[model samples]
Target: MPRLCGRRGNIRRLTRNSQLVQNRWLNRSAEDQLTDNENLRNQIAITRTNESQEQRNERHRVNTLRQRLARQRVTDTL
Candidate 1:
């Protein structure tokens, strides 16, 4: 009885969902939705890869500078 009453509650009434849910919800065209999901996943993967590459480049630059400074000190002491 409680479960039946709960189903009749005002909050249970359907309303227009927010934009994101509207876009990504299961009821839309399956092919288009899948494509959108794939594109989003690919973008995130590319972003992570680019971020990793940038960190690698920064680390390489720092190492190169450290090596050059060390060589200069050694040459000066000779």
Candidate 2:
């Protein structure tokens, strides 16, 4: 019983910490967010540039499937 209670308390503490981190990110200025997004896009572009043709094809196929599934889900919910 005591062990279970301790686990619950730890879970609550972790949840609170994650919420605090999310709130901090949301509170950042618009310029800061834009810069972060630009940096991420640049990183992704660099990574894609290094990938071989096979890897690029696989990534494209996976992305296409994901988009198709997402669209199907949206249509189902409508």
TM-scores for all candidates: the values are 0.35, 0.75
Q: How would you encode candidate 1's per-residue C-alpha lDDT over 1-78 as one tens digit per residue?
A: 564554466464554565557556757787887899999999988876778767878978999999999999999999
Q: How close is candidate 1 to the true structure, as a TM-score?
A: 0.35
Q: Rate the local accuracy (lDDT) of all candidates.
A: 0.78, 0.91
> Candidate 2, 57: how far from true, in Å?
0.4
Candidate 2 wrong stretches, greater than 4 Å = 1-14
| Candidate number with greatest TM-score | 2
- All candidates: CA RMSD (Å): 18.1, 3.2
Candidate 2 lDDT over residue span 14-48, tens digit each: 67678899899989999999999999999999999
- Estimate candidate 1's RMSD in Å: 18.1
